[model samples]
Target: MVISEADHARVTVAVMEAERHTAGEIVTAVAEKSDSYHDAALHWAVLAMLGVPAVLAWRPELAPRIWEGLVESWSPQPAGAPLLVALVGSVLVFLLFRLLFTWQPLRMAMTPGATKTRRVRRQALALFRVGAERRTRGRTGVLIYLSLAEHRAEIIADAAIHDKVPEDVWGEAMAALLGPVRDGRAGDGLVAAIAQVGAVLAEHFPRGENDVNELPDRLIEP
Candidate 1:
């Protein structure tokens, strides 16, 4: 779901077009994912591993069956054969769970939506600070951030714009941005979002005579 070169060009053009009528500097950014979320996967794997022993303990007969199946040889084994089998089985169970979590899709599935949302918001703010806020002359920079893996969109506007425009005012733009993302048309979504944002900014902050293009129109693909 990563944005391609063509998508980058489309978004850049959108930003350029949108900025023409407004003083707001619109920056678009797309990320593969907000976070690695490895910790969540590890927690899930540990829970699954722990369940193996609990299940075996509850179903005492199944433990003996597993032990017999593992040692079919008629050789005289120790009296603690069942306990040893349980220990080896538990180790194998833990390894299997850990290996399963190595798959990216499974690991992502184990992560909660709330965690993804928080991470996306954090990345968006960080990008805004670096890519738009510092670069814009009037402190009217806005960041349209998308996290493809998490299917989340975030809008981070600088203090100047945010002070006047309520947070809910950007809901329409955010919805437009996420609409295409939901359907795998990320480029189209970004363009639509830019247009919506431009309309809002144009109403509030029309381009001034000495207005300069303070920020680059290129897409920030971090």
Candidate 2:
């Protein structure tokens, strides 16, 4: 779900206030989802297709005639009957699962945490490159990216700050960011995260006389 207009305004103000204390450029971006995760969806579909045959083989009673012909008659079934049933059932199962997974909530739930994390990180880094990286006069740009569907966030810093700051240093900010997000308070999470990040930047790259607001203070919704 998209944040309210007030939340958008709050985010913009947070960025501006944060930037006031540090020369670092802070760009905030929120996305309903980072990636379609189509590959993961396809993988689950394929697994479902493959599983149908195994289930049929294990429980012949589910499709008895196809496996061993009529029980009373005891006739030998056509060798191809089971195979055909399996093929058709597999295709049907695959299609059913694929259709069900098209629903966003189910797909998001079924997706592995690692996959979501990787996709969020990848998207966040790309956004950082385009929106924040090296765009500042001091090469101290920071991007706080949040993926609502994935329930994950990424904090990417420009080269200067990245080189100086330990990656784990953002843990506190990320933690602060997600607590409110878990409660469906994404805007609050973002504001809190940006504040923490700003504190860090102010400490490392304190405001200078020649500091410039190199980036727009807006919440990018993409």
Candidate 3:
């Protein structure tokens, strides 16, 4: 999302240069975030609701006033007063949490890292299939996907590249990307990653005579 025109051009040029020496197709994509994580937000809200009782238990002095506030009883209350107060407290807590989580920073913080990883990988795979898979004649397409909010990246290769290259072989490329990304240099990181990925592709799938570029060499922001 922070990428500018210069950054976009750099990525496109890197991809084109990488493809020149190899028959592999490379697609670069960036997303602000992979998911909204509504489920994580809901879970946080529910936990807040569940915590109300524990909180009230710690501050017993608050219970009587809270109960009186809910029913405004001038007379002795029935046995159900405690239940009413609890319900009211839980609802208030839940609502407060929901409101706070509407702020994206809080919501993202509450989401588990494992959940974000899964969503980011899932989204990258889906995008690669749509934007790169089988689009080239040799089926040597590769995708470099960056999710900014999660600070994560994924590399997806098509049939030919997958058959020739081991999954661990892409670790250097991933590292090249994340190093700069973590430093708030996403564009530079992406360019470095494309070069790394391209080098791997070139090594395994050298370009053939009259090789044609079957895919565009532009960055996709979807």
Candidate 4:
């Protein structure tokens, strides 16, 4: 999901060309992932731990079988000692499962789709605020944000553009951007989306003689 230097250059060129006919300032950004989702991992670990006791409770024979084995192995130990060992063992199992989910892929897999969507949207908005909103002279700045891990893209337009442009109008550009992403061509996706957005902006905000590049054309990798 990494964006190559060559791809970054191509995206930058697309931004430059797109702005030629539009007063809208486009800013592009890509992030490897929106979040680590440690909380999701922790939740999964807790569920797994809780399931252990639930299973034992549901199948009473299962615990007795384990106790028999422990008795044979530690006959000299106090009866209560085996219970302590079992408790410690359960804790260890929970800890191990929790640690395993710390890996990004495992953690992300356990996360709900809705959660990932929220995180991606949150990240995209943050980028928009920093990179596009409140920066353009005409308040026509737009942000195209992509979160590779979530395979999600967001197109955020500043107040001026959003007021005049129908919300659904951005859907086409977002579709264009996501098409390439779905095909694993992130750079191409961004370039195509930029062109679509430029076309839309050109129609509504035609370039003026005083129009200048108010935003950097480079792709922000956050």
Candidate 5:
């Protein structure tokens, strides 16, 4: 199909908007569908592929071999270059939707909410119940909750915590929760450990010294 430039632009904008709306859903799907390490490895490979032009600019000799390999690997009676370019472009666009638009929001929206709570329950019922306890931590007393029901595990903390803690801490906490169970009763230590983690997070992302009213009772339902 011959896609016009105007049509392409319009479609791209629409896809981006849809990605913004469903970013969380896509991230959840990716997390559930694949291991984090595997996904990270794929991302690194793509980045490396993206860097090929720059790499070749510095080391031109390697380009001949790379081109030869690509040609050799090309199928017999292969599709025309234009068709191949179109196919590859389409795949990359969809991957951008999956990796950039979808996954970015999922990471940003990693907090306890109705949608996330549902996900946690799906993953582990016992963990969901125990992890649902919201606690005030640190001198500031930020609210943090951990949930484990859905395909992707999550730690939900108050928005206040975002600027305070180093990003790596959050990453570590998530890896811990999502990683394989170390002991037979891995769930046993989760709550206390998460609470302690919350305290540490609070120190960086402190809450108001005064207590705010707990969330409305309606918001508290499982």
Candidate 6:
């Protein structure tokens, strides 16, 4: 495919921006670009290498005799040796490509920007469940949960709020539910917080019946 000069320049800028955010060296950015190119090269090389062997093995004049002799020479000990070898070799090539061309550079490229760091903290608060627990490290918090559908992790707070919570008693609860002012079990913590916050806002400035009735129209509008 033809890549326009403008597009190439844009990509180069993006790569540089990513490096700057992550605090990566100039050589690291260049190496990342080179590794991406190398990954494409290695992918094509492996396909060509395997295709050559496959084509030779499938030739009409030689294939039948070769198959017959191979079957006769095989023992009951292990039937998948060749297939296993090919699979293992393919895996090794892929791993090598990842090691040499992708991992380090991509990591450098992913160095968190300030905006990204802020977003992570917001997500932690958003996903906090009522009884969810938290563990802090440096500038981030680990929010843990045990729900069936949404069991995983989230990064919450930052160094700024690390000591803001009075004690560890409700840290998990706050981490799970975002605000200590809200109540209920961990699983329902977020819902409770939203309801409480909404209620507080509604009490101060209640919506009239006419405004509430207009909700259907607002929702249905294209």
Q: What is the TM-score of candidate 3?
A: 0.94
lDDT of 4 by residue, 6-31 (tens): 99999999999999999999999999
Q: Is candidate 3 or candidate 5 better by lDDT?
A: 3
Candidate 3, lDDT over the whole model: 0.91
TM-score of each: 0.91, 0.92, 0.94, 0.92, 0.28, 0.21
Q: Sort by lDDT, best first: what order?
A: 3, 2, 4, 1, 5, 6
Query: What is the alpha-carbon lDDT of model 5 when measured against the actual structure?
Result: 0.37
Q: lDDT for every model?
A: 0.85, 0.89, 0.91, 0.88, 0.37, 0.33
The deviation in Å at residue 143 for candidate 1 is 0.4
**Candidate 5: misplaced stretches above 4 Å?**
1-151, 179-186, 205-209, 212-222
Model 2 lDDT tens row, 1-222: 568999999999999899889888889999999999877888999999999889887987666564544344466566576778788889989999999989878888889999999999999988888888878767898989999998899999999998999989999999999999999999999999999999999999899988878888899987
RMSD (CA, Å), each prediction: 1.9, 2.5, 1.8, 2.0, 18.3, 19.4
| Residue 32 in candidate 3, Cα distance off native in Å | 0.4
Q: What digit string (tens of lDDT, one per residue) describes model 5 on residues 138-197?
A: 212222223322335444433334345554575655555444223322232233334345
Q: State the weakest 10-residue window (summed lDDT) of model 1.
A: 68-77
In candidate 1, which residue ranges exceed 4 Å CA deviation? 72-83
Estimate, for each residue in 1-222, the C-alpha lDDT of model 1 and write its tens digit: 768899888888989888899998888888988888888877877787677777877886776677667677576567776667667777787788788888889888879989888989998888888888857768899888889999999988898999989989999998998988999998889999999999999999998888888887887878
Candidate 3 Cα errors over 4 Å, as ranges: 54-62, 69-73
Clashing pairs in 1: none
Error of 2 at 10 (Å): 0.8
Clashes of each: 0, 0, 0, 0, 7, 5
Give the better candidate number (1 or 4) by TM-score: 4
Would you give me the overall lDDT of model 6? 0.33
Candidate 2 ranges beyond 4 A from true positions: 59-63, 66-77
* C-alpha lDDT of candidate 4 relative to the true structure: 0.88
Per-residue CA lDDT of model 3 for 46-139, tens digit only, reads: 9889888887777766777777776658877777666677788899889998899999978888899999999999999999888889888889
